[model samples]
Target: LLTPGLRGSKAPAGQNENLQGLKEKLCLMGDANSKNYRPACSLCPVNWKWFGGDTCFYFSEKEATWQESEDDCFSHNASLLMLKRKSKLISISQISQKRSYWIGLSYGVDGWSWIDDTKLSTKRMDWIDLSSKQNCAYLFYRKSRVYSENCYEKYPWICEKAAVQLI
Candidate 1:
């Protein structure tokens, strides 16, 4: 099967299909850190300097409301709560144990979308269920790492400043 945005002149016959199958297989195994989660400092794909915790501080910027937090991330050309890998999720849980922080999740456009405008579409990816939604944004606590929150709530947050690299 040919996947959209995967066709190229150099691609071998059936190569894209095989690749897609492999990707689906991996996704079915849950995230990388499903069994045990941990926290650590690392660079995020969207360019935010991540410090494993419940909240990541941006230089001198202090905490703010969920909307304000989202705006702050946007000012830096980044978004809050975009996890590129499972280890990052573990780190987030290890970083802080408090009220849930706001993420880039929103209920505007289609049913829901990321702050970066990416549509929420994933069959293998798992999300933390909080109040009454399956596709809402995610927040991390020192003890747990998946929970939903109202986008208008005030909470300390972490935002991705830029993309260091794209995979």
Candidate 2:
């Protein structure tokens, strides 16, 4: 009701002075808990990592075939990681930590393509076999390169999807 005594802070006016003052003092002394800091809002799940600014990626710990991995991603409303930018490839490569991951690339009758059927010209890869034995592509044996491998081989995969804005 517009009381002058309570007009300054949103707090109850009495408790805030002591608590806020103490909290500020504690925060100044490196007490992280005193600030009640929270992590940034994340659209990705706890097990997923947000990458490329707009996508959420899930790096599987369990190995699966290309088809099985794709199926798993589909079940999660996502797809295998589809990358085109060399810079993005490098970013993921650093995070790969020397472990390989199946990407969304594969060879088909129409040449190499991403899972979404986008044609990928190979300025970023080599030894891309057109053989039916090794049609699926995986990432990070060498930094920033994609290598084709047997589609039936079991390997960890990455699933990616667009992060939705939570408003």
Candidate 3:
């Protein structure tokens, strides 16, 4: 078995390709100059995959209602996504694929709503889909717009927790 610090210190042949692909994708994503750099998920309790950013996101295949998903995320000290601008939304879309995930912002009794203490304002809000508002929000690949999906239908999710911004 080849140990991590091998004699030659070279990665397996195919592994380099995967790394390159990920790099290319990230390069295409461009810089993080927008105001939508929100936390996708945080890994303080159980260790999950590291998503490069300070935050961590999860893709749950297990089906559950929207409220149930929110409860699950809150239990872990994270909340759904609440994008601040179009650029941020696009950045998130790139990270997430076809699998849908719940975000913090949604349409409630008042029309457009967000989790308590969301920093976004109505003027800076951008809805993936203005027409679709079933009950909860779901993000999908190639979706120029967002969809309102049932909470019970499980999909991938992105969580967010505040980080101390460096001055």
Give per-residue CA lDDT, model 2, range 1-167, as digits (tens): 11222334354557555655544443223333767432222256678887636588898999999999999999988999887776677777778757788989988898789999889875734433344457898885565667779888999999998764221
lDDT of 3 by residue, 100-143 (tens): 67767566666666676453364734556645547677666577
Local distance difference test scores for all models: 0.54, 0.71, 0.58
Q: Which segments of candidate 2 are over 4 A away from where they belong?
A: 1-42, 122-133
Model 1 per-residue lDDT tens digits across residues 74-104: 7766567775456766666565446566666
Candidate 3 regions with alpha-carbon error over 4 angstroms = 1-54, 117-127, 163-167
**Which residue pairs does candidate 3 place in steric collision?**
39-160, 40-159, 41-56, 41-159, 64-152, 65-151, 65-152, 66-151, 81-104, 128-146
- If the candidates were sorted by their lDDT against the true structure, best first, what order would they fall in? 2, 3, 1
Give the TM-scores of the predictions, in the order they appear: 0.52, 0.67, 0.56
Which RMSD does model 1 reach against the true structure?
A: 12.2
Angstrom error of the Cα, residue 111, model 2: value is: 1.4
Give the candidate number with the greatest TM-score: 2
Alpha-carbon runs more than 4 Å astray in model 1? 1-63, 97-99, 130-138, 163-167
Candidate 1 worst ten-residue window by lDDT: 38-47
Which model, 2 or 3, shows the larger lDDT? 2
What is the number of backbone collisions in each predicted candidate, taken in the order shown? 5, 0, 10
